[model samples]
Target: MPQESSHADPAPRLHRVVVIVDANSNPFELSCAIEIFGLSRPELGRELYDFALCAAEPHTVMRDGFFTLTGVAGIDAADTADTLIVPNRPDTHVPRRPDLLDAVRRAHARGARLVGFCSGAYTLAEAGVLEGRRATTHWQWADGFRARFPGVRLEPDVLFVDDGDILTAAGSAAALDLGLYIVRRDHGAEVANSVSRRLVFAAHRDGGQRQFVERPVPEVPDESLAPLLAWAQERLGEPLTVADLAARAAVSPATLHRRFRAELGTTPLAWLTGERVTLARRLIERGEERLEVVARSSGLGTTANLRARLRRDTGLSPSAYRRRFGTAVG
Candidate 1:
């Protein structure tokens, strides 16, 4: 495994990331990898990744043949990367390139973290890395993938699946979710949230691909609890209840519960608690207040309660979270 970059240092060694592509690769999926892992993020205070694009053949024409990629390294580049990403294949029914499959297999054998985005799952499946592992792909290709690779367990509904060494994402937009997930796993929530905010995407979207598949109609803000949510966010320091939220929304508690489920995929209280935890995280990352003060200010009540909540939400105590993500700690 590659050594983690030290936070105390003025300059940190970046983790190497390589994305494999070919002529039939989906340009959107390829761009997703570039946007998340290949882009430089100077705001994080240190270089986080050294990203590159590679192909089985050099100077390959991608997708519609109108856009040609140049100066791309060969498959050997995957051998040196800490992470190797495979973007969506243009057609799931067509056979994958044997050389590309071999490169993916070799990278995994060398213990590099492997990721397959959208129809890219087909590449991994062809490479045999996803055999016996739970995975997912674009919903449109789920049945065909199952038929083609009967050995693999296909979930078909989640946005992504993280099976430790190997990860697979469903569809095109879900590729961003998987990429952000990798950033969070490697750095922390603070850094991932920063990237998400810059991209104008949700840092963590609730529920699975089911909501998107089941509901093709776009949701309007007025039909959602957007106004009520904004009102609640301003008063997170107060001990707000589901009934309080219901009254503020001018609806019965049961109606509010259904709306919360339909809109946020979580109960009202859970959403409120998640908000409090988010507030607590902001306070902790600021490193300006004591634990008790932070707890009280974020409506977590006390230091003991804060500790429990922090552990539950972030798998870290207040001090630990501050140490990892706080501005002062660095």
Candidate 2:
């Protein structure tokens, strides 16, 4: 695999970064920051950032509906941060708390870069920080957002949007892409990619939202299909039919279909197709290979079928997928 650039000189002072958590903050978004800035990266020979979790009150709490969070630091912890991150909000309909809004405004006024993830855009929007700015959020909330904040231009599809001082990212795990992007913007691609490698994730997804809006969600179960899936996984080079899978599972075709749906939340055919695509992705990520060979080994049968499946699942062709993932794996 390609390695990130190493800095031989003494590391510089780590920046002060704060992630503001709220009653509804997504743990995953907070994890993105912890991965990018909180973790020590001595192996990369790069100066790391001092990251803290901040909240509006002294003892913070999170809403898991009936469940509440305790032991979180108060919003005062964010007072001196060089960068302030407001993760996704629980609801877009409600306005931001006045104190929280003011805090965000003060942070930006003091030269801190502001970041919002998913519905967290609503906080920035309420703070007036996103006024006349190009931002984004979860696609499902786009219409409600536009209606609520007419001044902010909302781009519903991209993974994230960066306007130098302010950054906004779309739904859920897209926060990872935004965090990596911030690392790349402040440091370099090598540093960001290194962080990605440590997380065992892709180097970078295309920043555009188009990739997320149309991608098929794989709904495979790790348990129910264990044996048959294991069998299928080991024999990707051979053609396997529904009948073959049914026999292996000791079930009728109808039973197999029901089991796939009940266990995987998808049809048996779709599950098999996803398995094939997964195999192709692994091969493509491993290194350069002939398209026909990859297709054959992954049971995609032909380049045309591979192309169709790849495009359908990822909105990218096989060559494009290879170019993106293969280079990183190299």
Candidate 3:
């Protein structure tokens, strides 16, 4: 049975996030929610999210039997949350709690954005929220999930799937990707990048979980591409061609292309363009720099080019981006 909590707010708004915890929940997934949403980031100069942890049952013992969590609010907390997060359950074979599933359904009915991390997608599927919708789970459980929820359109290859109001992440680290993406979508790239920097994690990771599924342990050669990548990053302000990268790496263009595809899962030009956009965004966020200067410094070459690229990358003009994210400097 679900216990009731008196902590429910009378007025609810965006930025209210509730994480649902159940018996045998994965601690790491719960920790991801806590670290991403629950932690206060004063650097953003405002309260970003009002976060809470809610349980399906009171006085629940965690998967690790030694730990007993207490004082957590109940499923009612989720009813008013603007964003409801369901962390990964310990096992897909475990039975779904009816009370928690009902809470999820109700939250969604009230227009709360629902997110599931890792095997937490199973809960959403069990709740029928993922029915006829595209979702993904840990690749290891793909067969079982498919067998159980034949209605779900599962793309086990990707790191995460964002289906408008409903989002699902594939596995542990991918949870960070999805969380950061949400932050980026709601707030902006600058805030998300700040949070990423604080966490010492990549602001964005290229490719998907499929890259890791087969080669769980990725092999990098002794003469790895790290040095070449470092070299390219430092020279992002310059016009870099595949030939230039190949020359720097002392390898032919064909080999360099293969290396980039294998290691980064992207072409040299795409990666370079992304880096340039990142540099341009930082410049825009830091201070009041002229668009021409920003364009030149970021290697976009011209104000018109910068406008196009900025719009393409972030859907915001240079001036608009600065207006929104340039208040804080680090």
Candidate 4:
């Protein structure tokens, strides 16, 4: 909701992403976290974060004993993190280490951002951090999550839940989605897109999308929205409507809406408007001074609409956004 910049930055203070590795933790989600937050992007000529992996024990066995991991920081490393990724182990019935839970509670008390990938939401709920807060976990564990923590609002269907500082992803793959969303929030859409390009992943998949589509593979492969999305992205400056998108896709408006819901779990109009907002934010970050020009270029029509939408999505007015992120060529 309130979430880069062009050119090489002057060694800005990087964010910290400290991950608490648990015994028998699933490595896939941890790998996803590493790809998005830990790895340095030499292509960008600046670092995004100072990352570390902290474990409660000196020798932690991974999922199904695939391997034993060592040589990472201790659990106290979490206390120093700006944003901490909680542990995600596949065995939800097994309780986590009490000290680890204490670390989580301490992190929350200090206002550090917390994240849960897949079954890691259980850890947050267990530590009482998710009490009366929104979260999501792998759909298979949804019923158990609700039964255990009824006070927590569990959005079981969505790919991830971004409830302010605390966030959760529904499954391992959705870990990447949540990570990308965080990148978009921190660096703006342009930098996020650049990261997504390197990952070869879709730039943005909003949290509202269903964790898993009803059909993993379509009966008719050509019915996917990838082509339509590509076509729409290139023309964000144009006044494109749902009807226009439908016509281009050779489907009726009703069909388009259904496909959008099925494929993306969002309406076509909502997707188009979101892309426009991202475009406008990018323009502001890259030194667009004229609000009217940004509005028209992003197809948001007038400056009045631009101000409202930018504030609605970012909690920052157009000029304020420029001040915060603008890279002016003086």
When 2 and 3 are scored with lDDT, the better candidate is: 3
Across residues 1-330, which tens digit of lDDT does each residue of candidate 1 receive? 999977665555678999998777888888888899888787776656899999887777777786888888888888888899975776677787788888899989989999999888898999999999989888789889999999999988778888778998988888898898787667666677888887888776532434243223566545668889889989988888999999998999999988887776668988887778777887777674588888888888888989998897567877778777786212
Model 3 poorest 10 in a row by lDDT: 207-216
Q: Write one digit per residue (lDDT tens) for candidate 2, span 28-142.
A: 7777878878998877664558888877765445546544556667877778889899756666676667778888999988989999988989989888889999999998898
In order, the Cα lDDT scores of the candidates are 0.81, 0.76, 0.82, 0.89
Candidate 1, poorest ten consecutive residues by summed lDDT: 207-216
Superposed by TM-score, candidate 3 places the C-alpha of residue 198 at a distance from the truth, in angstroms, of 2.1
Candidate 2 runs further than 4 Å off: 1-11, 65-68, 211-330
Question: What would the TM-score be for candidate 1 when compared with the true structure?
Answer: 0.82
Give the C-alpha miss distance for residue 252 in model 4, angstroms: 0.9
Candidates' RMSD to native: 5.1, 9.3, 7.3, 5.6
Off by over 4 Å in 3: 1-14, 64-66, 207-222, 287-295, 301-330
| Superior candidate under lDDT, 1 versus 3 | 3
**Between the candidate structures 2 and 3, which one is better when assessed by TM-score?**
3
How displaced is residue 20 in candidate 1, in Å? Answer: 0.9
**Candidate 2 similarity to native, TM-score:** 0.61
